[model samples]
Target: MSSTHHVTTESKPVRLLLIAVAAFILSLFLLLPLIAVFAEALRRGWELFLASLKEEEAWSAVKLTLMAAGLSVPLNTLFGLSAAWLVTKFRFRGRAFLLSLIDLPFAVSPVIAGMVWVLLFGAHGWFGPWLAEHDIRIIFALPGIVIATVFVTFPFVARELIPLMESQGADQEEAAVTLGAGGWRIFRSVTLPSIKWGLMYGVLLCNARAMGEFGAVSVVSGHIRGETNTLPLHIEVLYNEYQFSAAFACATILALLALVTLGIKSLVEHLSGHTSNSRH
Candidate 1:
């Protein structure tokens, strides 16, 4: 006879000790830092905190960060969907190579990615003369920031969807096509419905990374205040300038964004799980 062990029957003291250790680690590494950010932010009072956020430089950083995420997320989403569909739905030469290429960003350091762009677009770069002659500024500008964010966040959506799409196979899509459905119709009615959850999850992750990207953006941004500065970069500048309250205040915004992202992620996972259970 085969026997199974129940994990719940483990020693109570051991379980309690493990739980305590996990909780302590989480609080030390995550909760403590989050609490510290807000505490320092509000140390000088609400007025100072509000004033820090209201500063023109801070507002500019916020806008730039939003703009970068807005541009990068959509572009990456489109690329992700296309790449996933192509890889999962069709067989072709160099398919393995293509998959590796999709994962290139993850393998590359963000700082190196940013520097590559600079070497290609900066004043003394490969296209420098051409860009200079055309008065097209990319390096140390909004475009550069967006480009860096895009590179840093490139793999998120595609990575999220590839395994999902592969598991789903192309059966439903083929059936739709055999039923005389057009390309867009097949995608909308069959493919999209199947992959919607993964798609949304990927988009959320991509947005979070785009907004929070620092190493890549910093290398390309040149850190010009009110121009190339992003929220993370702004926080670094504040801290470097010894503006502790302002720095912490700016950090609180990022912390809040991280919390909101986590909340939405949990909600998405919960909803997806509930739906899955119902279907089963």
Candidate 2:
């Protein structure tokens, strides 16, 4: 029989002290704030909680958030898959440079990310007058919101899949080709299954960020309630107006979304671990 044991370098008392300190800090910052939101949200009673969510402004914010996530996630998914494939499967000039470019969005601040769109698409912007002449809108509109979201969340899926697909290698794809499989067939049967969990993990994170994005969307959104405002913006608007309860109430949705994303990610990690173990 063979067995493996994890030996700690630190003494037991020291390890326990470190763990206790870390847990206390985590609870103080993360758990406490989450608890407060729910507590404050319900402080006004259940009627107010339901009413806050049911309000037209809150409803509109929810709708816009959903619309943004629904539109951006799929487009990003496609981009991510294509980028991952191109970078990992083929050798080309500037391949390293291209891979580096995928993370540019992450390095840029979200506020600056939004401003770039404004500069290009705003009325006084480079193409602004041309778009105006054509009666087309990009900035301060739904299109702007979607575009900002796409820019901000662009790195998530591609970053997730690139490393995974790279480590996987092209052996399976080449083997499939040798057996007369087409590109689509090989991708669907071999590539897709191999990367499905990574893809899902990326999408979950993208969706959450897409829904929760504030700074980039804020600059371009114009804060037009019932038209362009998202849930995060709505919360800010309410908080600014001193509607603490309603703000917290709206925040509950975002908090719940975070919790859901965390749960799914944990589950995915668990399953992935199981899969790797099973394979080995």
TM-score of each: 0.96, 0.96
Please report, in order, the local distance difference test score of every candidate based on alpha carbons: 0.93, 0.95
Clashing pairs in 2: none
Q: Which ranges of candidate 1 are over 4 A from the true structure?
A: 1-9
Write model 2 residue lDDT over 1-280, tens digit each, in one string: 1333345678889989999999999999999999999999999898888899999999999999999999999999999999999999999999999988999999999999999999999999999999999999899899999999999999999999999999999999999999999999999999999999999999999998999999999999999988899999999999999888899999998899889989999999999889978989
Name the lDDT of candidate 1: 0.93
Q: What TM-score does model 1 achieve against the real structure? A: 0.96
Over 4 Å off in model 2, which ranges? Answer: 1-4
The sequence of per-residue lDDT tens digits that candidate 1 reaches over residues 145-221 is 99889988999999999999999999999998889999999999999988888999999999989999999999999
